[model samples]
Target: MVSEMSKKREFKDDEELEHGKVVKRFNGLPQFNLQRFCYRHNPDVQSSVGSTTCYKQDANRLKSVNDKISQLPKNEREEVHHVVSTFRKSNDKLRKLMLEGILTACCFPQLSYVASEVQNMIRIDFISILPQEISLRILCYLDCQSLCSAAKVCRRWKTMADDDRVWHRMCEQHIDRKCPNCGWGLPRLHMKRARNPTPTRCTELITPWKAIYRDRFKVECNWRKGQCVIQEFKGHMDGVLTLQFSSRLLFTGSYDSTVAIWDLCSGRLIRRLSGHGDGVKTLYFDEQKVITGSLDKAIRVWNYITGECISTYRGHTDSVLSVDSYKKIIVSGSADKTVKVWHVESRTCYSLRGHTEWVNCVKLHPLSFLCFSCSDDTTIRMWDIRTNACRRVFRGHVGQVQKVIPLTIIDIENLVVDDKQTSDPPTDDPHDPLTEDLPYPTHILSCSLDNTIKLWDVKTGNCVRTQFGHVEGVWDIAADNFRIVSGSHDGTVKLWDLQSGKCIHTFQGKSLQEPHDQQAETAPHKVSPIACVGIGDSEFFTGDEMGYVKRYRFDTT
Candidate 1:
């Protein structure tokens, strides 16, 4: 029992020694040493205990110094006290300089071992003196992470960083210059007039641009990391051929002879429009109506709200392969080797006969003045909607041109010349007739069954770039200003940089097979071909030949 007691006593001693060592190590740190020195040296320090003891010592020292001055001659004491008091109340810049000088002096041989507590009292007002405009311009160069850090400095900095204009400019420079929530670049005047009959005063509301940027940034990070919520839509019994998306609705056309409207948020079937005599091949929609073209060689316009057919356009002599509409104008490509433009309200049709084989895809420009079409004859043709004339023919694809889409043009200040070269110096006069007559220089993106995607200059009719990565035919393609997304029979979805024309990412789908897996090798390799792709602000949708539609969110860690 004595031995056990002695062991316990020794253990307690060792434990106390270990704790003392820890305390000694902590006290040796520069911050703690500075506090200890201040407490020991300051004349007015009353106690050397607690973390804040040095602060109280500073106050006491000031009082002690003033008491010494009080003992001097009356006129001398007043002058000295006045000087000390004024020095104490000076601006922070002078105080920081004095503190730094003290720190430097303390680094000398005799005082080197001592540390001062005055460093913590110094502050720098780097941006407060600058004009707000210049300050904002400097802040604009900071990326998202640095800007977020700058917001935490102080109340003034927070207010300046959170200015809506600053955030709006950031969104324009980084994110697309569109409402991240509504996906609209600018609100349409006609939409307001059509909704309200009394002609109410339309006022533009300032959006929460910072919040929008945060949401978009989070979604893009999600995409890069492959973090997404998977929801499978299984209404179509056959392959889905085409799809279109708005903020709230998803419209899908299928070979099952039906067009289904779905609640995009819930992924639930809202209604089915089934009037086509054959498989529905292509579809387009706006806030008011939906137009679908089918293998029955007819284009039908239906009221989306009521699911009632409003008008049937019967001009194509063969299967309508693709269709696009903007406002009252509609363009359709048919297997009869012709492209037709129709005025939806007046029912007037104009034929553009150029391709010798089936016209597989057609796209109308957002401006409604130009149309682009691709055909199985390995050619893409641009049409002028006003004159109903073929303006240019682009020939590069060696196989069937499956899809064509216009590249979103954000900066059109410099135009591309006829030789596919950019003009070095932009024309000075904005109203130059020669520049105006140059027919808005744009680019077209086309994918073909030749396992390649090509970028063409519309004004030059030259293939400016060709991107090749797919092991099989490239079937469908979609693009924004920054990236091009393509779906292929290779059972993979790829993301390409639009500017550099380099494939950056390859996304594997369910149909992708492992090369070395015996079980996968025994099964059919080409069971599912990606047929259509649709892109939203945060996510993208791809439909395969198995009738599976997938929504993948963006993630980057």
Candidate 2:
């Protein structure tokens, strides 16, 4: 060991810090970049700053500094801590010198003590007096999650981050930001493989976000900052059961037992058509008309333009559970164990009777004009709509099959569907469940009373995967060829990956415990399960057994 009296540890000038002599005498050296420390502390120093070798040397010097610190006496350690803590409270040069003097007396502990102090004092409030623009720029340099959390810390920060310009810049930095369905210029194989385990359809994952921003409040809209508007559609009573949009109109069926048509662009409540005696269960629209199924055991066809109920077809003895229409025919399934077909214009109905229990949902294959239905019997039925016969039964679910959709089917249904329309065909065709361009019709999603969501290959008649996490039976399923949205009896909606079947996030409207405890029975099926689900843009909407409806905007930045 070197003699203490002969060792000169204190630096007389900045140039000495660049020399290795001070550290050469010590053993407890820290693994740090002394050159970075030198540059940060004295920006005027112009040494050889461009060499990698210099960095390695700084690392060695840091090691020496730490080694020397380990040998400090106990009183010196306490004195160092006290001086450093006091120094952090003010930026005076005298205080910094005093702190350095005490730390040197304690054998100069590693700069990590300084780094820790800096990190602990790195709150955004330090620059609150600075120009809002510059302060926001500094905030943006932080991680996205921290920025979001900081914005929520107080009303002042919330107002600052609410600036659309800041949010738009933040959005650009997120790795998983892209079109909801489009991969960011990636090839199909990489995209598919990337999607397989995670099943994120697009290149990037989007969190459903619902934060208000400054641009939304401005009368002079700047689309460049990103177009976000608080558009509200009003018509439903209690809550809306389900909503669907076409090129021109938005159709909403509600707990009030009525279907309302609204102008999509204006968010205006155009007209409300009343027919169902109980809450509407589900509704969909094709080129020809709006088809609605309700708890009143009826499926009604309405004129899209006039909002007039054109024809009401009734056959099922119990409440109609789901209705989906293609080309000219309306297919409806009911709690009464039957799938019925109706002619949109003539109002004639034919029942496809085979299910042993409640038919929960119906989907039409576009090409073959096949009709598929899932039921409480734990089975899915594939039918030939033309023959009105059951073509096949896919049975394997431990709980009810809440939904069935065909990714692609024949063109015959579209031809028949187009001929029945009173208006011209849409210029750009709306999304059809039966187009061959989409992936396998086998990609099926079903929710069940068993507190799980199941994905299946309906064409292969195989259950592909099961997603568990929902505390109650899943009542409905919706997807965008990547992620699956499920509604549950647990009073929440969940988003899950189709491939891994992992739950990514959940959205809840109300707590099940908040409702009447007496109404909640211990019986397995006693609670109202999620009855229906629909997705719009970044929002997921769920309707429950008690007629409550809620919308949750995902939290993607």
Candidate number achieving the greatest TM-score relative to the actual structure = 1
Model 2: per-residue Cα lDDT over 307-337, one tens digit each: 7788777788999888887777778899989
For model 2 the TM-score comes to 0.50
Q: TM-score for all predictions?
A: 0.68, 0.50
Give the Cα lDDT of each candidate. 0.73, 0.60
Off by over 4 Å in 2: 1-240, 246-249, 262-268, 344-348, 408-440, 511-530, 544-549, 553-557
Question: lDDT by residue for model 1 over 1-557, one digit each (tens)?
Answer: 55555455544321333322312323111233334344333322222222134533356666787789889999999898786677668776897886677667664653534433334433334344345677788887776777889988876677778878788777776665433333323211112121223433441222367756666667655644557666667789988888888877888899899998899777899999999999898998988999999999999999989999998999788999999988888899999999998886786899999899999999987563778899999999888888888777788899999999886565443222233334334334443322344346378899999999988766556676788899899989998755678999887898875656778777776565556778886687654778888876566788887777887655323
The TM-score of candidate 1 is 0.68
Off by over 4 Å in 1: 1-124, 131-134, 154-156, 177-208, 366-368, 411-441, 512-527, 555-557
Candidate 2 local lDDT, residue 203: 23
Scanning candidate 2 in windows of ten residues, the lowest lDDT window is 184-193
Per candidate, the number of residue pairs that clash is 8, 24
C-alpha RMSD of each candidate structure in angstroms: 16.7, 18.3
Q: Looking at model 1, which ten-residue stretch has the lowest summed lDDT?
A: 186-195
